[model samples]
Target chain A: MGNRVIKMSTLYLTEQGSILHKTQRRLVIIKNKKIIQEIPIFKIDRILIFGNIQISTQALSFILDSGIICSFFSSQGKFKGSLRPVESGNVFLRIAQYERYLDKEFRVEISKTIVYAKINNEIKFLENYSKTNFKEIIEELKKNINNLKDKNSISSIMGIEGHSTSLYFKGLSLILKNKFLFEKREYHPPKDPANALLSFGYSLITNEIFSLLSGIGFDPYIGFFHELTYNRPSLALDIVEEFRTPVVDKMIVTLINKNIIKEEDFQREENSIYLNNIAKKAFLTHYEKRIQNYREIIKVQCHKLMDSVLNKKIYEPYLED
Target chain B: MGNRVIKMSTLYLTEQGSILHKTQRRLVIIKNKKIIQEIPIFKIDRILIFGNIQISTQALSFILDSGIICSFFSSQGKFKGSLRPVESGNVFLRIAQYERYLDKEFRVEISKTIVYAKINNEIKFLENYSKTNFKEIIEELKKNINNLKDKNSISSIMGIEGHSTSLYFKGLSLILKNKFLFEKREYHPPKDPANALLSFGYSLITNEIFSLLSGIGFDPYIGFFHELTYNRPSLALDIVEEFRTPVVDKMIVTLINKNIIKEEDFQREENSIYLNNIAKKAFLTHYEKRIQNYREIIKVQCHKLMDSVLNKKIYEPYLED
Candidate 1:
């Protein structure tokens, strides 16, 4: 909103048993009392800490109080949570947001816009894989989008979304050469490598949107499209629907089809699959690249939502051309 | 709301340049690489870190994720901020709270209740010190309470509160053996030892209420009596009003009258006064004792507030008998 461009340097602390220490103005990564890496604190925009990493309270408090976004993830890449600094001083915007959420008509209308954009992005993403014939699946997705227009309640919209997602995943399987590893979409414990990638990518993007929305002073817990779940950033989830295909999904396709990520890159544990450390690094590289490219589009979509809530403007979701 | 009582063991880290390290199930406090103190993590309910104390991220995250409240303070005992865990999953309660805040009549009614309780407690506290004649000031406070019944807005209510507080502190000066040091009330940089104690005590109690209210799922930012300011926990401040006299002021009187804290205990820095390390340790001991004694009363007061918000019950403030 201020037209100030922030250069994002996301520092990932993936090494287990490493300590993040503060030395003067730099963050030093120490392992077994040896300094492994060091970076100036000012250059870092955000920190993504993986499992079992230790950071000094001085460093933790410094980063938090400095207003840097710090998020935590499990070793397997599940989003644990983030340490948010004291909230912004914008109570009026939150009140406006609550008013919109309270209004059923406005809620339904915004949900429709979000669902429409999500399905539209899905179709465009599938269509980009020119080798695959997603004609039947695209028709089904379009039908689901049309079905969304008549859906009144959030549950019904979610029903249509669920149906479209299943079909979209079916379409995705058709496009990937490594289709055997991804027969269907399994969420909780992604049974296969592709599902694992999807879940991880979604978690990363959702965390991004959560930080962005909070920075913009919106209550990310309340949402129109997503149900108000306990401790979930529902509004961020809602906004992230539009970005799934353009940001994460498209990148997932490239990772698989380009052989950028190999089958062996995944490791299986008790029926759940996850990217190995090397594969996660590769995945993050592409993920960060995709995010950089689409960051402006993401900000614009967030602004559109703010306008919808604060100015009674019709919410327009981001759809890839 | 749960009848399960939490035994509060507030672990205060007062040693400057100390590191809080996690050793299996225990927290080890190390100063100059020497173990100064060790406590079982389970035995600790909350941690208060003061000035230059470094904590390992492992310990900080473990404490926070385990729902233990951790607060930070300056070396001179100024409340910096706290690290709160993820919020409770009670969106509906917050919505109800916002609706009440929006209703001008309900807001005004609740503010009156809170202010009435606060002034009543102040009078009772002053009355408790029999060595002083605060009868005229008590009468003036009663007048202020009566004046509150007719006030329709927060600002005018604050006006009454201001006048009553002046009279109350004037009464406080009469009760204190060391009256020359504290002739009047000063807030921002408490000019004298009495003001410093008051500010520090209020901060500790206010933080306690903030954590309690948040744990009960109330948005601590919104309030009835206090004007919504940026990053200030207004609702906590509002609730803390009823606590100021009973919890903080009474303790201040004891500290002064009993010579538990000496005049020389305070350190002066360019017109501002603060409690030194030894005096702070003494103050925290008594503060914790008072909190333990009044914990049930505090919880009941919180429940009364919850009932008022959720059930539209007439909000009754906690008045000292």
Candidate 2:
């Protein structure tokens, strides 16, 4: 199953009032009774529907029957929910996962591997992009990575991870060419344009990992690093930490430094900053490209996690070069 | 949360060539270019759409947004799948559930309690309606009920439960007024009319419990007595054991004995017997009535399970008086 490679295409329905209709094997997007786009449904792998788009029940059923995942998001790209096929029928893997989650030593071992890889990736990213300007901060992050060996509890590892992330983001703030004021990492409605871009990129990557994990038959709610939180996909969160610096943070830094996205491109509403439509299109294009390059790595990481859970293999986190 | 009672209504779209449309706050069902039914959307608690029914994307979104579960079924009432809102935000409860599932002693304790109540309810049902004709079977079931106390493992308890159920069904066969021949329990396409009714009723009740458990934030895929099976909601299956005799089994007995569902009302296709449309309607009506009466008991049992998980309280199953 892991070796089989399939070309995947994602259809995004971002138009507010467009309706999705089905015609035989094709999906037609219509806005105000005007045909805007048509694609063969077989060629599409998944769909991301943004705010207020209507779909005909036939099309909805067809998508579901075809086992295509459809995710719903607010116009601002806040993930509302998703509709996926019945989860993979692999209860034994989940049982193995539950057993591992119950074992404190196993949880600590896996959590440390994840946190170590995350900080390593952060240091690599910093060295590649902003080494001269942020040398002390980068060395501080490297020290924290080494310090992870002595951390015996998940919360203590989290404490080191939190401090390292703050330093990494502070280093990132220095690398911006567009004078984007990013003092610290703020989210749940990111405050600054840099933070907003980071948050959006993280969301996209997190959703990708979430779908991948579900398809691989792991209970995405259970995790080793992230403590259990209500409605939070903790396992997905744990996996995404490894990808954060390599995927989202790197792309976000490039987007800001290359002037591909400007400060004015983001709009502020009620103390939250988000990319406007045009900027979102630019960001998504780059985001998709970066994700396409890393898709295999993400899949491999997931399979490794499965190996750790099921075969009791020592969990190894993905380290960026 | 359990104490808040709300009126619920289910809309079943069984017609093969119908379309569902949304207008403002109402849902209109159209067939053959005519409006067949129009219902206020707010009045619907859930929807069950049978084969080939088309629902507008607008209506589907409205249903999802309203937090109403929509389940799909085959024309012959086979359980297909469902669309539900984002699951409740309660990860702590799930963690507690996982911890309990991982404890061998707790698993056995809960499993024994569930199986014991299930058999006791079966005995009560048999004694209520078929006491004189099947006295030996009832006595045998009674003996197995006592045997449950000595059962130390979930599989052993399941052994007793399975034997008692077979004996209970044998007793049920003798009491049928109509010439419905149900020699044993058969499923995955019930082979006879009696098994068809039983399977259909169980499917409905199981779906109800599945939704109930999900709404209450339990991972319905995990279980105690029922070993985890691929793609199976083992937890829901465990809870439904207690309801089988009191709800579905009793309804099937009444439907068969009262001659409400004649043998002629069932149609055989390939190797499976299924209720025809009219008979399905009659059976569903009675099934809904029976479910309405036991709804509170089922909810209470779920809450008790929650208490057992969260508080480590003694888990008790609901037994018929």
Per-prediction CA RMSD (Å): 3.8, 4.0
**Cα lDDT tens digits for candidate 2, B130-152:** 35767888789889988888888
Q: Whose TM-score is greatest here? A: 1
| The candidate that achieves the highest DockQ relative to the unseen native structure | 1
Query: What is the model-wide C-alpha lDDT for candidate 1?
Result: 0.82
Worst 10 residues of 2 chain B by lDDT: B1-10
lDDT, candidate 2, A43-64, per-residue tens: 7777888777887767777787
**Alpha-carbon local distance difference test for all models:** 0.82, 0.82
Q: Candidate 2: where is the Cα deviation over 4 Å?
A: A1-6, A21-45, A257-259, B1-6, B9-46, B54-68
- A144 Cα displacement, candidate 2 (Å): 1.9
Candidate 2 local lDDT, residue A137: 91
Runs in model 1 lying further than 4 Å from the true structure: A1-7, A32-36, B1-7, B32-34, B131-133
On residues A1-321, what C-alpha lDDT tens digit does candidate 1 reach at each position?
111124446777888889998878888889999988887778777788888888777776677667777777777887655665665656677778889888999998999899999999999888876644688889899899888878899889999999999899888887777654688988888888888898999998888888788778787888888988788778999999999988887888889989999888888899788888888888987887778878778889888889999999998788789
